[model samples]
Target: MTDTAQYQHFNVFLAHEDHKSEPYHKYLKASANYETYELKSSLEVDGILYVKVPKTSQPTWAKFAKSLTNSSIDELQNNSSSAVLIIRAPKATMAVTFGYGRHLLDMECFVTDFGIKTALNTLNHDTLRSVDVITLDEQGVQKKSQASRSSNVGVFGIDISKDLLRGVTGSSKAGVGLFNISGSGTTFSFGKKIKVKDMPALVERIYSYYQSNDYKDSFAWVDNIRRLEEKKDIEPLNKKLIDEISKTNPNIVISIPEMLDWDTITGFSFTRTKRNIKPTIDSSDYYSSLDKDNLSIDSLKRDRLFVFDSSDEDPEYKLYDCLYFEIKGSEKTYILFSGTWYEIADSFVETINKLLAEIDITSLEFPEVYTWQETSGKGKVVEKIETEGDYNERAALEKNYYVLDKKLVKSSRTTTSIELCDLLTKDQQFIHVKHRKGGSAGLSHLFAQGNVAAEIMLGDRKFRVAARSVIRNKVSKDIVETVPLEKLDSTKVEIVFLILGENSSTLKGNLPFFSKVNLTKAYENLRQKGFKVTIGGVDKVVKPMP
Candidate 1:
C-alpha cells in the first residue's frame, strides 16, 4: 500500500451511559465549550444511519440528547466516545466520523469504564468526514488549533484528525478564502481539517520546543502547562501569556494552513522506544479495529492488535478471544495476554495452514514449541493419534481375547499391567486402550460398527429377568438384569462381548454361545457383590490401590 493509503482517521466523544440518566452531574457538566473525546475507525460511509431511542421520554431535544446518549446501541460503541459513525465505500475502504459531546472532554482520556460511550451509525456521503486532511508533523505532533479558553485544540484537533474525522479542506489562496461553513470570523488552520484562532502562541511554543535539544522534556513541560490551565481554583496566569508574546518570528505567529484534498497522499508514522528484545518462536501479534464489517484482517495481521466495541456489527473477533499470527524470518513474536506470555513457535507449516486464510502475511516462518501449564484445574491432554485404520481395524476382527494388549502409562510414567490381557492370543480378541491424563476421562466407550449405537456399559446392571417377555410389576418393570462376574456360580465362563451396536438388553439371549456383557452394569454389580470395583470403562481401568 502507498503512504496515502495508510492514513487513518479518528473521532473523540465525551459522555457515558450515565450522562443520559444523570445529565446534572458535575462530571457531565460542560466546563469547556468544545468536544475533546476521540473515536477511531476505518469504515466508509453509507446513507441511512439507524438511530435508536428509549421508549419513554419527555421532550424532543431531551429525546435527541437521549438518542445521542443511547445511540451507542448501534453497530460500534465505546466508553470513550459518544458514538462512532462509519461510512462504507465501494472499494472496501472506509471513511469514519467520530462524534464528541461539546464540552470539557480533554486530551489523554484513558479508556476507562466511566469515561464515555460511542455509538455507531450510517451517514450520506455529504455527511461523512474523510479526516484525511489532518496531518501530524514529522515529530508526531498535530498542527495547532485556534480555539481559546486554554482548550488545547491542537492536541484534540490532532487527535480528532489523526484519530477521527477525515475530508478535504477548502483552499484559501484567493483573496476570498473559501470556508465549509458560512463565516469570516471562523479561523482557519491547515485548510478544512483544523481551525486555529487561539493557538498561535501555543503553536509557537511547540515549534520552539521542536528546535530545542531536549524535546521530550519540553513536550512534557507543555503538558504541565495544560494541567495548570485545567485547574479551576487558580487565576489564569499572564506571565505565560507574556512569555509567548516575546517571540518575534512572523512564521511562528501566522498559523499557515496546509492545503490537502481528499485525494492527497498521507501515511501514518509510529515511533518506538529503543529497547531490544530477543526473538522467541511461536509468539504472534494481532491488530483489528473497533469497527466491524470494515474489519481488515490484513491490517490486523500487520498491527498485531484487535479493537472492538459494543456497537460493532459482530464483536466475535474483538476481546482478543482467538487471534492467530505468523512470524517472519528467525525473529520471534511474543503474545502477552491475560497476564501470561504464549510463544507462537509452531512449525511453519502448522502455523501457516491455520492462520494463512485469516491474514495477509509475508516472510513468516515456523515457531518452536513453548511449554505452558494451566495453574488451576487438571490440564489434560486429549489428543487423537492419527491412524491409517491400523490397530483399530485389527481389534474388531478378533474375538474371545483382550485384543488390546497394553499396559497403563501415567504422565509420570509408572506402568501397571492387567491380568488376562494376554488372553488376546487365545481367541484373537483385541482392544485399544490409553490412559486419560489431567482429568477424568468421563464416560467413554468403544464401538465395533461404522456408527456407534451400542449400549456398551452402564454403571448399574443387575435387575434383569423383570424386563423379560412380561411386565409383571411397575417398579420391577424398569429394573435391568446384571450380576457380578465373581458371584456367577456357572460351571463355565461365558464370553461376554461389548458389541458396539448392540444394546445390553437387546441381545435377548440370541446366539447364547457368546455372552453379551454390560461392562458398566457388571462393574456396578460387582461393587454391590462385595467387591471393590471402580472400572468405569475398560479403556484404561485404574485399579484401586491396595
Candidate 2:
C-alpha cells in the first residue's frame, strides 16, 4: 500500500453494552457506525473493540466494572493499539462515572485511566491531536443527561481528593464537598462526606476539568455542585457549557460583582443612582492580546452577552431585552444587550438610579459613571461613530498631537459628551465588566475626537473639514469645545467611521469610505489619541452631519 494508505489514523469507539441498546450503546453506534465485537478466541479484528457485557456484569457494572466481560462488547475485538486504534470520537465523548459499588468493601477504584487500563489490560497512548473522549459515571448513566440535581440526584462513584481541593481554594480537608448553585439564586452547600448519588455529577465535572486541564476556572462549576446539598437551584454542567465559559477573555475576567452602589439624579452621577450593572474592564492602560481577540460578538457569548442585528425581514424589530453597562473605574463603556435599544436604555437609567439611592457612598469616591446615551434606534451591537486617533493609533502619532483640516471641521455643532448608546437585540444578552474599585486611575479613558474629514455627497460634491487631536498640556485632546458655533476651526480631530449595513443591497447609492472600518480597530485608534468615545451603528448608514 502507498505510504498515505499504509499509515493513517482511524477514530475508535469503545463501549460496554451490558444494558442492551440503551443510550450509551445507541450513542456510540449512531455516532461512528461502531459495530459490536466479542473477545472470544474465534472472533477478532485489527483495531476495533465492541464489548457486549453480559447480563451478569450489569450489577457489577454499576459498581466498578470497567471493560466488557470479554475483550469485546461484540463478537469481534482487538486488544492492541495500531494505526487504526480505538478512540472516543468528539460526538460520542461524555463525562462518565467510575467507582466501586457502594456495598463493595475495600474495592474502591475510580474509572481513571489507571483503573480502566488495569481492568481491560490496555494502554491509553497520548495523542497530540485534539479529540473528544466521552466517559460515564459509575452509575451507568451520564451526569449531564439528568434534568436537575435538586430532586435528590445520585452521583454513585466520585470523590474529590482533599489535596486537589486544598490546592485550588486553600481549603484543607474541607470534607468531600458537593454543591448545587443555580442561576435562580438557589444553593445547596455540602461540606465533604459525599454519597454515591451526589458523586456522579461532581466527579464528572472534576474529571472533565482535569482531563481538559481547564481547572483554572473551576469555581463556577464547583459552586454549582455546592448548591446541591442545600436544596437550591443548580446550574447544569456539561461539555457545551464549559466550552462556552472557556472561550471568554480570561485576563480581565471576573465573577459578577454584587452591586454596592446607592445614590441621586441627573447626568452621570452615582449620587443619584445605585450600581446595578457589573462588567469587567481592562486592568491595564491598553488592551491585552486576549481582550483584543474576543471583542467580537462571538466571544461576547462567553461573557454571557448575546449580540445580533435585525435581518431584511425585520429592520425596526428587536429580538430581545437589551442591557447596558459602563465600567466604573475604566474609560466609560457603552454595552448593548441584543434586544430593543430604547427599552434597555430606559431600564438601565432607572435601575442605576434605584441602585445608587440604596447604597452608602459617603467614603467611596465613585471613579467612573454610567448612564444611557440617547441612541437613534434599537439594534444589535451599537456604539458611537468610529474615528481616527483612537487607542490603536496612539503608537502611530509622532508626538502627543495630531492635526485636523478646516474642511473636516464642518459646523461648530458637535456632541461633546464622550458617552453614547448602542443597542443589542438578541436573547439572553448581557455584558460582564470588572472595573477598578473607585478612582480615576481605574478608567481606560480611551477616547476619540475628530471633525468631518470631508463633506458627504449631499448629492455629489465632497467637502473637507478640520478636526483632530492636539496636545492639551501635553495630553491629547480632540474636542474643540470653544470653537465658533457657526464655523468651528478644528486643528485636531478624531475621524469616526462605520461599516456598510448588511442589508444595503436595495440602496441605489455609494457608501462613504469611512463606513468600512471595524469597530474594535476604530475604537482603539480613537483611544490611542486619549479621546474617550462610544460607538453605534453595527452595520453602517448615512452619517448625520453632527
On TM-score, the leading prediction is 2
Q: Give each model's whole-structure lDDT.
A: 0.22, 0.22
* Candidate 1 lDDT by residue in tens digits, 41-102: 22211311211111233443453555667454333323343322222222221111333332
Each model's TM-score, in the order given?
0.16, 0.21
* Span of ten consecutive residues with least summed lDDT in model 2: 161-170
How many clashes (backbone atoms < 3 Å, residues ≥3 apart in a chain or on different chains) does model 1 have?
Answer: 76
| Tens-digit lDDT string for candidate 2 (275-306) | 21112222221112235433433333333311
Note the clash tally of each candidate.
76, 126
